[model samples]
Target: MDVVNLNQFCIIFPCYVMMILTILWIWRIVNWVWIRPLQVEKSLRAQGFNGNPYRLLHGDSRDMAAMIRDAQSRPIHLSQRNILPRVLPLHHHIIANYGKASFIWIGPEARVLIMDPLLIQEILNKNNVFKKPTPNPLAKYLVCGLSGYEDLKWAKHRKIINPAFYLEKLKNMVGDMSTSCSAMAKKWEDLFEGRMVIEIDVQPYLWELSCEIISKTAFGSRNEEGKKILKLQGEQAELTRQVLQSVYVPGWRYVPTRRNRRLKEINSQVCTLLRSIINQRQKAIELGHVKGDDLLGILLKSNEKEIEEDESNCGMSIDEVIEECKTFYFSGQESTSNLLSWTMFLLSVNKEWQDRAREEVFRVFGNDPLHFDGLNRLKTLTMIIYEVLRLYPPGVIFNRIIYEDTKLGHMTLPAGVHLLLPIILLHYDRELWGDDAHDFKPERFSQGIAKATNNQLAYFPFSWGPRTCIGNNFSLLEVKVTLATILRRFSFQLSASYTHAPAYVVTLQPQFGVQLMLTRL
Candidate 1:
C-alpha cells in the first residue's frame, strides 16, 4: 500500500506542476489586460478625467485608426485633422470633445494631449519627467544615430555632441553656408531666361543646399565622401518610409523579408561610408593634413579636452563618435533644407510678406554680401521666418514619455504613458493667437515672439528649455542668410502647378512639392 501511494504521488506531481504553470500564465494575462489598466484608469478618474474604456486586446487602436481614416477622408485644410489620417485622426476629435486637454489610448498606451499654452510650457519645462519619446523602432533603421538613443547613453552622446553646435563654432561655418547658398543662387540665376517663368520644384534645390552645407561643414574640403553618404542616407530614408508604411509584425526588425534585406544592405552601405569618412579624417589628422574649424576636427579636439579635464568625462567611444557624426550629417541636412523649403513656400503664398522681407533683407544687407552682423539686423525677416515656423512647424507633434507617476498641473500622470504636445495644433489655436491664427501674418510677430504669444511658451520654433535644439542659432542664421541671398537675386511666386499638401516624413514637407515660378528681379 505504501508503494502504491508513492506511485500515485508521482503521477499527481505532474498534474500539480501543470496547474501552477497555468495559474501563473493567467495571472500575467489578467495583470496586463485588466488589472494594471484598471488601476491606471482609476488614477485618471480620480483626477476628474475620462476617456474611452480600455479594451482588453485592442485598446483604442482600432477606434483611433477608424476615426483618423474618416477625418482624413473629409478634406485637407489648415486644421491639423486633415494632415495625417493614419497618424492623428484622434487629433480633431480630442480637440472637439475635451477642449484643450484630452486623453486618448493607443494600444494599451495612454497619450495625454496637451495643447494649452500654459500646460505645454509646463510639460516642456519638466524635461526630467517629460523626456522625448523614442521614435518607432523602424525610425532607428532610417536615422539610427543620436536621435534614436535613450537613457544614460543618450545623455552622454548629447554632452559629447553639444560643442560642435556652439554659436561661435557655427559662426565659423558661415562661409561654408554662404558658399552653398551661392551655389543655389547660381542655379536660380541660370533659370532666369529674361522674364521666363521656369516651373521649378524648390524642394530639390533646398535639399541640395542642405546637403552641400552638411558636406562642407561636416567633411570640410573633403566633401566628396560626404556626398556619397548623403546619397545613401537619402536611399535609407526612402527605404525607411517604405518599411514604416508596411504592416508591422512583432520582431519584424529581425525578419528576413525583402524590405528588411534591402534595409540591411542600405544600412551596411551607409555605415561603411561613414566609417570610411571617419577613417579618412583620422588619417588626415595623424598625417598632419587637417586644418580649420570643420565640425569633425572641432569635435575631436573638444572630446580630447574633456578627457584631459576629467577622467569621468571621457570622450565618446569610437563607435559612439561614428554614430554621432552620422547623426550630424543627416540631421543637419534634413532640418535646414526643410526650413528653407517651407519658408520659400510661405513667402511664395504671401507675396506682400515676401516683398516686405525682401525690403528688409536689402535694408540690412545692402549691396554687400551677407555677413554675420548683417544677418542679425534683418529683424523683419526674422519675424517672417518665425511666423512661417509657427504655422508649418517641421514636426506636427513631439511626444514625452513619463517614467514614473508624476503631478502634471492638477493631474496625476501614470508611468508608461506619453504626454503629446502637438506643436502644429498649438500653433493654430485661435484662443492662443486670436482669430487670425490660421492666417499667414508675419506682422503679428514684428514685435518679436514674446509679444506675439504674450510671453507664453507658445513660440518655440526650436523647442524650449535645456534640451532646446542645439543648432537653433546655426539653423536660423542659415535660413536668414539663404533667404537673403535668394531674394537678392530673384523674385518668386507660387506656380499654378503648385499643390499645398503638407506631409510628415522625419520633417513636415510639401507632399506634391512646392512648385514656384522664378523671375529675375
Candidate 2:
C-alpha cells in the first residue's frame, strides 16, 4: 500500500510541474504580444507623439507592406527629382499624416522617427546610450562584424580594423581599383565593336567592378577565391533583405522554411570558403611567401599585435575574422557600386555636369595613368559624388535601440523603444537646404561640406560623429578612381529605356537597371 501511494505522489508532482510551465509560457506570449505594446503605445501618446495605433501582434506591419507594394507598382518619371515618396513610402506616409515627430510600430517595438538634426547629432554622438538595435536572428547569419558589435567589443574590433583603411593603405589600393575600372572600360569598348556609340546597362558592370576591386584589395593573391566569396555574399544580401521586410516571429528562424534553409546554406558555404582562404593565408605567412599588405594581411597582423600587447586573450578568433571578412566584402562592394551607378545616372541625365566632370578628369589626369595623387584635383567630380550621395544615399535610414530609459533632447525615451534617423528626408528638407533642396545641384558643396550646411549636422552621407563609418575614405577613394577611369574613356547619356526608380534593398539601387548610351572618346 505504501509503495503504490508513493508512485501516485510522484506522478502527481510531474503533472503539476508541466501545468505551471505551460501557464508561464502563455503569460510571456500574452505580455509580449499585447500588454507590453499597449504600455509603450500609451507612453508614446502621452509624450505627444502620434502614429497609427498599435494593432495586435502585427502592429503596423500590414499597412507598411501595402504602402510599399503600392509605391513599387508606380515608377516616377525621370524628370521628378524627389524620391522620398518612393524610396521610403511608409515613413513618408506616416510623417505626412502624423507630423515629423512620429512613432511607428515595428512589430511589438515602437520606432520613433527623429528628423531634427540636433537630435540626430545627439543620438549619433551618445553611442553608449543610443545603441545599434539587435539585428534580426535570420539576418545575422549573413554578416555581423564591427557594425553589429557594441561597447568594448565594437571598440576592440574597430581598433583592429582601423589600420587596414588608413590613408596610406587606401592609396595602395587605388592601383587595384583603377585596374578593375580599366577592365570594365575594356568590356565597354569591346561591346562598342566599331560603333561610335553603344547602348549598355552599366549597373551590372559597376557591381562586378566593385566586387573585383574589393576581392583584389581584400585578399591580394587569393582574389579568385575572394571573388567567389563576394558572389556568395551578394546572394546572402538579397536573402537577408527579404527576411528584414517582415515582422520576425520568435523562434521562427528554427522552422525549416525555404528562405531560412537557403540562408543557412549560403552562410555555411561562405564560412567554408572564408576558412579555406584564411587557412591558406596563415600557411603562406608561416612560409614567409607573402607580404601582409592586403586588408586581410593587415587585419591578421593587427590581431596578433593586439593579443601580444593585451595579454587578455581578447584577440579575435577565426570565426570573428570570418565575420569581419564578410562585412568587408558586403560594405566595401555595396557602398561604392551604388555611389558609382547613381553618379553615372545623374551624370547621364544632367549632360552639362557630365561634360564638366569629364573636363575636370582630363585636366587632372591629362592622358596619364590614373594615380592616387590626381584624385584630389578632380574637384568637379568630387562635388558630383557628394551630391549623388545626398540625393540617393546608400543607407536610407539608420536605427538605434534604447536599452534603458534615456533622455533625448526634451523627451525622455523609454526603454525598448527604437530611434530612426531618416537620412533621405533630412537630405531633402527644404527648411534646412533652401528651395532648391530637391534639385541635383552639385555646386552646393563647392566650398566643402562645412560651408555647404553652415557647419550643421545636416549632411552625413557616411554618417557622422565618433562612430562614423571607418571605410568612408576607402569607399570615396575607390569611387574616385573608378569614375575617373571610366570618364577618361567614355561619355555617357541615359538611354530611352531608362527608368528613374530608386529602390532600397540593403542599399539604395536602381530598381530597373541603369541603361545608358556610352560613346567612346
RMSD to native for every prediction? 3.6, 1.6
Lowest lDDT block of 10, candidate 1: 78-87
List clashing residue pairs in candidate 2.
none
Query: Highest TM-score among the candidates is held by which one?
Result: 2
Q: Give each model a TM-score.
A: 0.88, 0.97
- Candidates' lDDT values, in order? 0.75, 0.89
- For candidate 2, write residues 43-74 as lDDT tens digits: 88898999999888888888777877788788
- lDDT, candidate 1, residue 113? 78
lDDT of 1 by residue, 467-493 (tens): 677667877888887999999887898
lDDT of 1: 0.75
State the displacement of the C-alpha of residue 147, model 2, in Å, after optimal TM-score superposition. Answer: 0.4
**Hey, what RMSD does candidate 1 come out at?**
3.6
